[model samples]
Target: MNKYIIYLIALVSGVLGVFAFSPFDYWGLAYVSLLGLIFVAKTSKKSTALFASFLWSMGFFCFGVNWLNVSIYQFGGASLGVSYFLVGLLSAYLALYPVLFTYLVQRFNVQSAVIFSVIWTFTEFLRGWLFTGFPWLQLGYTQIDSPFSGIAPIFGVTGLTFFTVWASASIFNGVAALFNGKNPKIALFNAVLLAGVGGLSAYAQRIDFVKPVQNEPLRVTLLQGNIEQNLKWDPDYLYSTLEIYQKLIAQHLGKSDLIILPESALPTLENALVPFFERLDRAGQAADTEIVIGTVYQDVHSDKLFNSMVSVGNPNFPYRLETLNRYSKRHLVPFGEYVPLETLLRPLNSVFNLPMSAFQSGAVAQPPFMAKARVFAPAICYEIIFGELVRQNLKNDTDYLLTISNDAWFGNSIGPWQHLQMARMRALELGKPLIRATNTGISVFIGAKGEILAQAPQFVETALTYDIAPMKGKTPYSVLGDMPLYGLSLLFLMLRGMMAFMRRRMNLSQKP
Candidate 1:
């Protein structure tokens, strides 16, 4: 292949990935990123491997996260140069993972089709966990629409990534063989792996792997204020925002058993929420309902603020703020919610220009919050993506899963949809209904099968009311956690290491 052609291939494949995974269509484009890796391996020079990897990553992040321009230029009020610099720096950092993977693969000389598959997948697993762990844009997500999605219930995303890369390498190698005017055996092997991924997915979809017993039916309502982030804190908008939510709740106050609002829907601290809490108590009493609203709660003792979801109105009586169900946001954005390296980077907040960039960390092992009639396991924003976090929250009495996010900052990009897609996977994995309420849009209710039961459109100010049965049964993923998947990965690493050691010994023995 020509030199420039390889670069073009990387760029094209990266763009395709952006399109496929974006909110517009199916997410199969993530698998296409592996193609860029192949291009680097086959055509790029060894010394230039890092450069090739960086270029491929640039293509992926630059296009995939184009929506960042909105937040930076429009929201953060940064200059074009600064915004572009930040995006470029982030892409360069993320690109290092793939570059490191490429370097290791080349060093190992484990080029067999099967070995290569494991090697690629192991790197992805590491990428997800290394450095605070940003598992965004995993190739397995693209296969969600394909038959390969069923494997998520069994091997998790890592296994699907393994098979996807295997299929990619097979097709790339097979195509290369045909171009070189040779036999197509390698291509056939690639086709078989691809077929197998699809076959398993189809089979898994048809089979009822999870048998969740409906313990009781719960009626709920999600309130989406569709309030603009800019004016949310303004005193002028406060009354209207509060009134809008109040009016929306009044409609469902008596009708539904429970009412839900988006993250920070109240936009007030615990002390500041006395009046509203009183009104909610009175309303719940009159209507005979339990209202769970996403509000900002501050711990008076620590004075550490939390993005929390609290429930009001219970059967136990007295209304001095029933401290029932609560979940604080575990994963905060690097610069958005809180600035990292506060001493060093604090100055950059002024230079780079950020909005409300300080937040306190929440306890990881906190107990699940109690609600009206059920116990709610809350995951604020990005916490939903962490599979282990959800699994750890599972308890014998845990009823439904709740995730509240302020996607208003992500704007109208693929960010919200990707979030919704990931949230859906968690529901599927645990065999529990997940209710996600967002500030801007994509507030949805997902069934145990990962199917969308009810949803509100993006960039809308509306309310959704639905009845989902709280489930008691656990899925394979919830019971085993990542133990099975991590164990298999460790086993692969040990076998690979042994094979390498034996090969080295044999080479030494054969020496003159």
Candidate 2:
């Protein structure tokens, strides 16, 4: 085969893998893509394999997250040329993970499937938190609807990534052996291994890790304002946006137990919207309902701002700004919520000048907001992607998980759908019902089993009203988190290294 042709195949395979995710959801494509990657890595030289992996991941990130350019060029006020350049730069940087993974595997001559799976999973885990973590388009996310999804509650997304990669490697080895006609037994074993794992996963889907709490389902109303991202912060549009949400709340106030609003539903600062909040609090009191709304809150002492969700008209607490319960977003988007290396990048473009771009992160260990005697773990915007962050917020009595996002920044793209999928995974991992409200669309109520109960259409001005049964008990993934899977990966890597060393010693003795 031609060398350049191999690289092109690798790149195309990565591009094809995107279809396995949201909007497309061709799950089997992930396996085919991985097989292509394995072929390139095994056939090429070390340097060629490194380059091929880089090209492959570049294609993956470039296609998967191209929606980022929408926010940069259209909303962030960056020039078209700069937006494209930045997008390319970001994709290239993310591509390094695969490049390094392939390079290391070849450099150390690590041929064991266990070692490869461990390294791939560890690389993914590192990418998630290193440099404030981009963790988007993780391999495990593609399996959300696959049969492998059954193991999500036991192992979390990282575990799923490991299994997916391991299975792909097994399939590749089996297929290659069958074609060569030199290792029939090995090929048969691989086939049986793959089938057995799939069978177990199918059976695992029937297991209920968490039981429904015997409490009455919460009657919830999610408000989608469909506010334009460009006009969201304009002073002129503030009152109109407020009025739209106010009317929505008024309509649902008496009818629902809880009324939820999208992130940044109020464009103005909390202090500026005191009167508006006061009125809503009065309405909530009158209707005997709780209102959870997203807005920007600033600290008077430090003058620092935070992206926050505040609950008003809770019969248990006063509507006072200081006394009202709130959950401030902790995981902020780099260069979106706050710019990194502000001194260096702030001068480059109007992108860093976005409204609330300098917002501060909330405390990591903040408690969940209480509503109607039930605790709700709250995540704002980009925060939902971090499963451990959500898991840490959950407690023994936590009932529901809530995430409010302003996905209008993504415009008409797969970004919002992917974001919603991640939220569903979080629900599945924690065995908790999730209430997701978005600025423009994709607001949904996901069940404990990660099933979508009800959702609103995109770019629509509407509200979704539904009753969600809060679940009790914890999934094993929730209890152990990702530590057990990490440990398993480490165990496999160590075992492979020990076996390799023993084999080396035996060969040396035989030669002597």
Candidate 3:
């Protein structure tokens, strides 16, 4: 086969793999993508390693996250050319992670192929954590429907990602060695070892923690309120937006015990929502429901604005103004939510013309939302990806996980599916039933075992109603967190660096 053709096939295969594991299919495209990268990298000449890595990453991100075009064109009001350019730029930036990983792997002439793979994973693990973490495309999320998902409970998503990369790299190296007419015995043995470890992971998935002793189900009405992102900020659309959500709630008001809304469901400013709250409070009172709606609230004490989840009508306090069961969003998006290096980036903001160009960060240690007898752990949109953040917020008695997001930004891309995949990981790791409310679709109710019990289609303006039992059982991840994986990954990186240094020293000594 022509070398150019091999590289092209690898790129196409990687792109196809992304679609397979996406919402359209569950055949493990994520795993295939990682494997495809290794194959592509293997075909490259040593001189072209960096270029090959870049090409693989570009193919993976550009095709996998093409949904960014939706925001740039549909929401940001940019032209097709501009949207394409922006998407390409962002994907290229994401691609750098794989390039850096491949670069480091080549520098360390490690004897064990498995060890090399682990080092590759250690870089990926760091990419997901260091610098507020952009774990958008972690490999383990692809295993959501695979047998290996069971490993998540034992070792968070990072560990699973590390293991997947390690195994894939080992197999790739072993196969290449065989093709090159080298002694295939060592490679064959390592391949068998990888298979054995993978089988163990499959078996481990069957394990479950103790079930909740006394399960109390929470009847949740998740509202999608599929509002147009562009019109959401328009003052004229405020009443219509408020009416649409109010009407949706009216239909299921008495039917559900707790009603939920997507993030920033209130299209108005913080102060402007006071009147809307009065209406919601009255509706909750008349309909006999406790409501948790997403709104922007201004904290007078700190003079800061927050993306908050406010509660309306606690039945116990009939006459009292309903207090907020607020969860201020901790993980704010870089350009969309808050501009980093504000003075420098603020200029680019006007050029790109992003909506809500700035938002303040909320305290990480804020208390969980108090709803009826249950305390709900909340994560706003992007916050769901951080395993440590979720683990930290999980109180011993916190009954369930609640995430509110506006998928209008992601549009009809694999981005929503990727987001859903990551969220499911949280459900698996913590063994908690998750209630996800989104604007413009994917309003879902996920079981503790990471099963999507119920969900609404994307781009559909609808409310998804479901009842889930909030169980109190902690999975291994919930108990131990990512501490072990972090320590091990760090040690591996240090060891790789030390090995590289020793190899260079040995070469100098031998030459003398």
Give the TM-scores of the predictions, in the order they appear: 0.92, 0.98, 0.90
Off by over 4 Å in 2: none
Report the C-alpha displacement of residue 144, candidate 2, in angstroms: 1.3
Judge candidate 1 against the unseen true structure and give its global Cα lDDT, from 0 to 1.
0.74
Best by lDDT: 2
Worst 10-residue stretch by lDDT in candidate 3? 316-325
Which tens-of-lDDT digit does each residue in 201-283 have in candidate 1? 78877766555555567788888889887777666777898899889988888888888888888766656877778778777
Q: What ranges in model 1 sit over 4 Å off?
A: 176-187, 212-215, 317-324, 351-355, 500-512
**Considering only N, C-alpha and C atoms within 3 Å, which residue pairs clash in candidate 3?**
none
1 or 3, greater by TM-score: 1
Q: Give the CA lDDT, 0 to 100, for residue 108 in model 2.
A: 80
Q: If ranked by TM-score, best first, what sequence of candidates would result? A: 2, 1, 3
What overall lDDT goes with each candidate model?
0.74, 0.87, 0.76
* Per-residue lDDT of candidate 2, residues 1-512 (tens digit): 77899899999998998998898889888888877787788879877888889889988889999999999999888898999888999999998888877877788876666677888887787789899998898878889889889889999988888888888888878777888786688878887888988898888889888888676899999999999998898999988997899889888978999999999889989888788888888889889898888989997778889999988877667687765478888989998889999999899779888778999999887766887677998989898999999998888889999999999999999999899889999999999999999889899999988889998999999999998888988899999999999998878878887988999999999994
Better of 1 and 3 by lDDT: 3
